[model samples]
Target: MRTRTNGIQLLRNGERSVDKQYRGQRIFERLGNVSQAEAEDWLKQRQAAVDAQHANQLREGDEQLFAAAAAKYLTECQQRGVRTLETISYHVQILLPYIGGMRLRDVCNDSLEAFKDARVTEDGVKNITVNRSLEVVRTVLNRAARVWRTNGKPWLSTSPLIEMLDEKGQERPPRPISWGEQAGLISRLPAHLQRMVLYTVNTGARDDNVCGLRWDWEVPVPELQRSVFVIPSEHYKGKRPHVQVLNDVAWSVVQECRGMHDDYVFVYRRERVKNVEDEPVMPYDRIDTMNNTGYQAARKAAGLVGVRIHDLRHTFGQRLREAGVPEEDRALLLGHAIEGMPQHYATSTIARLVDLANSVTQTRDRTTLLRVING
Candidate 1:
């Protein structure tokens, strides 16, 4: 005989049993010799309990475990193709012990404070480090409230407020590279790295933009009698299109990189592993994302410990100012949206941008630049 128990079902199969959902989990219960009416009554009571739990009148019968929620969050991130999935997963593993079993409702200010203290006092973690972990946690919870849902109920009524610790003391001042330091640093780098650095400094492009640049994005501008890179709105920051006119020096680097790789404009030689297969292969067009750790040894050898690859962009912006390029023209050539202007500009604006780009193409002693790499 088949028996009903709320949304669950109970039937005779050599024993009396019921199947039901409890706290978002499927459970099988065996009630030996119990009547079908009894199982139905039990299920009704459980449903009432769940209602109370959701009403905040009880803490039992309904719980969202942190570990389970984290799994759901990671799945969403994977679907979105977040590049930091592996890194975030590693951090989640580290955080499991602190919050794996806690109910979602129990994640209050005190609980977060305790987690922070444990990380700082016992694990000796820095505040900034703790903040990054908190960022991942915050992101997961925010999605649960704002986007995640099941059966018309959001995983959370609202996302918890995550306050970031003040990092005033840890904030490093910006370092704009001088031409001489650029000369020295580039000389010590490998041929591929040298070109990447040179291209970045000249074009004012971020490391990711430089690395992710593809040949298909380049468009021939017959009006300007040359080609320019036009990064799509999605790829550029602020979701706006970025147009870059290749200066004389930067264009030379691109020409040399032609045919080196099938798609990417920049590629580095990856050394083979010792005795591991025939070759220790590395991915092409890859940027050392950990703040350029691979280039540290070369940077130190050049006696520039404080310099960073990002400073190359700053160098470009500064050089533009030094050369008396107007702010509006500089911003245009450097691929930033012109604020306070109509979305559409006159056709002559392209010529204006090209003129400003050529103005900065004037480098100090092209011979010195060529000699630095022994080219």
Candidate 2:
């Protein structure tokens, strides 16, 4: 005998039977009484109910569930090899204070616009700072969308809140140090730092490159005869290898610094040193001490008002132009990438760089330079 109850069919298996209650529903079975057909039908119905429930939950458009998206985005950033952990952490901190609890879907264009306005007017933030903050938000959201797409979810198509801020009309005022000022500043610095300052002024090398210089990296090529600082790609701002030719003055500075620090080229301790086992150690205090006392006192004594340590780099570019070096050569010496070439283009040889620096030094008449300085 067979019986149909709530669309389930049961058959008698010779003589035994059992009754079961599941989820407020009663079911009956006998030994071999419930056919495979009946089991299949029940499973299909249960699955359909589950699917319907899921569809309803998704339709609610709740953002609370997407909190994990930010964490996933941060993990992805770490994997992508972001060099500055402090910079990334700062960006994350700024965004979290503003929208940490908000869902990805809740962050629309309007919300972002309001945030920008608040940052600029209310917080008195600079445009560049605000621009960077927006970039952090945009990167995270874009990463989230990508992760969702990779996981086969279609809920997110793109980041809705972030876009480039228009900067077509804004122009920055020129801020290069004058040649007379450079000479005065150079004269005031201690004999040790004078060469470093000159090299920085001539080549526009950043503070780190100037201070972090090492002797082993200084190679004297036969053709050039003069030693050149070979900045490894990893240490360079462009993340590419480059060679900076040292002029007579700059090379003299290197030699002097070499005498002071036997192992390292520069006197200041390198930020992030390595031990005998070749593990990186924390940055030392020497560089900061040099910057605050020695560098600052020299600048003040020189009477070079409004000058910064980095102004030497600007002076380098300006002096290059004054010396009649072409724009292309100037850009090359500054370690900037030329259009149509990759960032890692071969750097100028030590001889050529020396010639270029010497040309700038030779062209200016000392008497005329004095007249300008006196004026």
Candidate 3:
């Protein structure tokens, strides 16, 4: 007897049979008829041939090669603009030496674990440094897996294999200078650095802003009736241009520094102008170098410890808060992005900010007067 199995006729000869179509063709040609057993045997052989072909493809593990995948992954990263050339260079320089030759299929939990351990103990690097390097590697591999999935290839299956060391590496909190300390430090600093520190403290402007100050960027806001320093986007870390108000103290510093240079607005030892190439030379560089050297000397002279240049800005913020200036207004003066529900309120002018800053002294005077009268 013969029956249909998956659209092909199965037959039995002694132990196998030929397909009916083959038998038909044979009979038509006056050849011997094929038995059912022969047809069944031929079907099994065809299936076996397909299975062997698939097994051969499985053995050929060329797709998951690490070097090729990493190269292609880097190309994709560049194309997508996800990472910059400098950043990619760092990852390649640091990470490639460790796992560059390993195949993707060969990567396992133990391999990643060993790499992490070796990075810390063998290299004697900090845990934070090792963590950063591992993060780059993991990101690249995961990106590769994403690309593979899009192409309908087998996933790398090792994204979850890597583990990061648990260490929170954050910068230390800003240690602000007290009012008395600030005044003493300022008095002890050289004339140029004294102005810089005073300006930074009074206006809450960043070091870069004060250092990069130029006369061309100053603009007068009619509403505030005061001139403000307009910082260009290129010079700012936030990549946004901002207007900073110079207070009475800040204006005094600016006026004093004005005699130094009409063009640069600040200068140190008056280097003779040689050519047009010297036009964009930063005036604050010399002043800052002098300031740093003088600051250390001053710190030693005053017997103070742990005083940094940045503490001036922090001191400004802390003083504003202590003076009862509204937090929103303080953030605006400090050039911090406003947040929360109060950001919708009307924007205050520079004059108002100056007034608020002055109010701190007045409030203290009023409290002192009340205490004296009660006593």
Best by lDDT: 1
lDDT of candidate 2 at residue 328, scale 0 to 100: 74
Residue 200 in model 1: lDDT: 84
Model 3 bad stretches (over 4 Å): 1-171, 222-225, 262-266, 270-291, 339-348, 360-375
TM-score of 3: 0.50
Clashing pairs in 2: 233-240
- For model 2, what is the error of residue 181's alpha carbon versus the real structure, in angstroms, after optimal superposition? 1.4
lDDT score at residue 362, model 2, on the 0-100 scale: 51
Which parts of model 1 have CA positions greater than 4 angstroms off? 1-62, 83-94, 114-132, 271-285, 288-290, 336-351, 361-375
Candidate 3 per-residue lDDT, tens place, 1-375, comes to 435543243334323333333322321111135554555556666666666545443432334445555666677767765414445657566666667656666655566677777777888877767777677666666765554663465456445456767665534456666656666787887776787788888877776677668888877666655577777666665656666766677777887876566655555663455664666654543343323577788877765556566766776777777788888878767778644422222225567766775553332223233325534
Alpha-carbon deviation at 331 in model 3, angstroms: 0.9
TM-score of each: 0.68, 0.61, 0.50
Each candidate's root-mean-square deviation in Å?
10.1, 15.1, 20.3
lDDT of 1 at 139: 83
